[model samples]
Target: MNSMPKYLLMALALISLIACKTSQVSTTPSPAAGMFKVAILYPNGDDKTFDMDYYEKKHMPMVAGHLGSNLKFYEIDKGTAGRTPADKVPFVAIGYFYISDVAEYNKAIAQNRDAIIGDIKNYTNIQPVINISEIRQVVGNNTK
Candidate 1:
């Protein structure tokens, strides 16, 4: 049987996730109920090299290009260690992209699904854990 490409599958899943409880875009980590996107990438087995440069320079730009305005503030976290120093990190990196609404973000990804999925190869070989979730600002800025 013919199966959809992995990236396409990931895109479809992301779209579905957004549709169910979808959107908010912000620079802060505050969870705004129905508006946030979080994508995490894990290392594919023993592969040690994760091209951080390409991810920042090439892959993300391609994603932003297609996502356009729907793409709000986003963050990338490169894992250095787990809860302790000895334990290895579960995932290599994480991406958090916020948008105005779920439906709009879903539409944006659906339209540029191919390009977005295809660009994954430029970064890592592992399949990322993509999740659409609500952003809740548990703690406000303490500096103020």
Candidate 2:
């Protein structure tokens, strides 16, 4: 009777340990879970007028007020070598915003699409190609 109780307690402890391990794995964010929407805007030419003014004055304020979200803009100076050669690289401007829900994102885009389009038309001489992308953060890198 004593041996039976000892074996049962050991079995229960093993089960509890396994459950805890599985729960930890399940709660962690997967590679796909970290995916976000990204937009890339390329300049028409060497024109600094549109890019500079739009970012500093018009676009930044409007995005902050309307979307209640901060925007991160990057100028693609150095290309990714074999992946994206310098010669092939367009004068690229990349914008990133956090979007957790697709439905909410689409709704916001719809609401502000026309205003953004108009602003681009008035400010930029070169039409920008907007590309939608799914972005995943690289592991073990300090993005902050």
On TM-score, the candidate that comes out on top is 1
**Candidate 2 local lDDT, residue 123:** 51
**What would the per-residue lDDT of candidate 2 be over residues 1-144, giving only the tens digit for each residue?**
789999999999999999998888444433344455545465534654355556546764564354544223222332223334545435444454544554665667678988866776555565656665566565666788
| Candidates' C-alpha lDDT | 0.72, 0.55
Give the distance in Å from residue 80's predicted Cα in candidate 2 to where it truly belongs: 13
Residues 59-84, model 1: lDDT tens digits: 77677676677677677788778889
Question: After superposing candidate 2, which stretches have Cα over 4 Å from the reference?
Answer: 1-35, 43-49, 69-89, 141-144
TM-score of model 1 (CA atoms): 0.68
TM-score per model over all chains: 0.68, 0.50
